[model samples]
Target: MGKAAIRIGTAMAALALAATGAPAVAGPQDAGGRAAPKTVAPLMGPRGVDALGHGRTLVTETGGTFSLVVERKHKPARVVPLGNLPTDFPPAISKGPHGTIYLLTGASGPPPEQRPSVLRGAAAPAPATTLFKWKRGWPAPKVVADISAYQKTDPDPWDQEGFPADSNPFGVLALDDGTVLVSDAAGNDLLRVWPKKGRIRTVARLMPRTVPVPAGLPDVPPPMGPLPPAGTPIVSEAVATSVTVGADGYWYVGELRGFPATPGTSQVWRIRPGSTNATCDPAHPRKGACKRYADGFTSITDLAAGPKGIYVLELSKKSWFAFEMGLPGAEEGGLFLVRDRGAMPRVRELAAGRLKNPGGVDVSDHVYVAGPLFGPGALLRLR
Candidate 1:
């Protein structure tokens, strides 16, 4: 059977297995929310026939340093310094085909500007580089992407309005074919760049500045009375905190809503190739787009797609939750696996212990999650 067919079949079987109450092959859970030890096949990297094989994991630290960890030992294999990264650098790293590592670094401190907006592009040289030559360690990555390329092709008001260009880039994914996708939370857009080909494109622009809320949804409290003066812009701050491209070539976006706000919400959006752009009101240039794939989650910080479905990593009041994606009908879709944190104990255990503020996730036969923490970020291996 074809790969897609096999994935579908496996998904159906997993669903049936759940319905039959068949015990999971391995239960990696114990009291106090820790994962119990169980013997399982070690994760392997992709081989000749397998498209999704487990392999070595690499993680980047906040200071632009990287550490490689082998799966079997789960110990640090090597540590290297990434050049051109700033002291305030916040790094996002991903492994391209054949173990080439791509690192994305954000601008250090806030620019000398005051605006309730996220950064869009990097003013300084983006701290991006490729390491690991294939013959020796991994293939050295080529400079195949630039965030500014989109500004040149399709200019948006955010570009002109001083939306922080080098906002935090929290996620990175390398396609098997060398296409690199980076999610800039500050810019609220998914950037696609082909360094090898010197091509740049904005695969999708999100939350155009005209998204509307329900009418009569009191802009202010009764005591406060009238809303802020007319012409006051309503900045959505719909930051794309994390992103992952599926084997089928669809891009999944996770929005971290309301940074620096009390009681923040989160959302998940799926954008397929050739999707249409929603109309933006010329009069209200700062409003966000009306068309959206899905919404309504509380602080979805990371996302991953596997044979089962899209897995969402949610942060609520410093707590974490896992949501499975489901396409309900023609009107976008909704999230499932709600409030069932135990269903994915691996994620739950990570959240409970090491994974604070997780920003990226990728799943194949085994799951790999990355996030920012003290002492060089962590790459958790879930098998």
Candidate 2:
């Protein structure tokens, strides 16, 4: 599982702590004292957002409904429902050629036993990780790709749990050629899909990184029991969560490093155009088809690339675990911009200490962020 694991696990953790009457855990706190950015539209748990041009934007709620927000100069923005998606959690949306809309939903985590067993004449269910295509005047979107089906057949080579492949299709990028790129957070890979052919091919695989555990964690019971000693280095999944096309015509991906969720362990990777089966391992970073473009990010949930640079949105300013586990001050998230500058790249935080559990971001004429993620959220515009 990718984002779902975090969301669901957080809920369960909160419930357990409440039952046990435990005190709030201490964790990372927001550092910025600057004023928060202005809100563009009030939304309910908005998780995915994309700019639709002409002062319009598309946003998706955690409950599956889509919204279209229209902004006018010196006027309050208007919000309209764009209909609900079939999935409970729609993660990403992209505009395809000729007004086509591509949306992604679902993640790996349904128990194996939960798979409906086929009896006498019952048909099997559709794959959960799906890519949907829709256009105006259509009743609903049509399934263009079954991402989980491909994952089942071609499992993750670096799967930590062993057997039973995991596939959380989190990020999507639609190209002018009708081919779509998807980032699978659980599978730790990037896939290229041909909508017309209903075929999928692996573009790159992200290798797990070794992250040092942060200090000040408590030891608990079985299941999630005991924390490893602080500063202990452990291997973590490369939870690749986002994909965006850069101004240079190259593909950019951001990772949400898994378990222990060490802050500043995530990295943004760059993949060459037309690359296939590329490796994004830190061990052989430069030698592979995928190379590190930027590093030292924490729990990046979404990325947006523009002519100037790329916008990176973190789910939590602290590590995701700190936020998920409800550490005292881990409520605040962050937004950052990464820009190329000669031999060095500059990473700057924007509207610091303003965002809380921000999930998705995109740039058209302006930068748009969606957040608060678990509660009543909103779509905010950068100044």
Best by lDDT, which number? 2
Task: Put down candidate 1 lDDT per residue, 1-383, tens digits, no spaces.
Answer: 00111121123223222323222112355334567322222211100011134464454443333445444457533333223232223335566676565655443232324222332221233332211111124322234455544444554434323544434445566767887776655566676667566565666555533322222222444643454444344554555666765445667777655322112245555566433343222233234432233444545556767765566654333212111111121111111222222323122223233333333455667666543222223444443
Q: How accurate is candidate 1 locally (lDDT)?
A: 0.42
Count of backbone collisions within predicted model 2 = 0
lDDT of 2 by residue, 1-383 (tens): 23434343235234233433221111233345444566888776677788976789988765556768999789989997655555556788888899888887766323335433432221133457888877776656678998888888878787665643778888898998989999988788899999999899999998888889888666656776587888998888888889999999999999988878889888999899889999998887677779888888988889999888988889887867787666765766788899987446898998776676777999998888887665566788776
TM-scores of all predicted structures: 0.56, 0.88
In angstroms, give how far residue 272 of model 2 lies from its true place.
0.5
Off by over 4 Å in 2: 1-35, 108-126
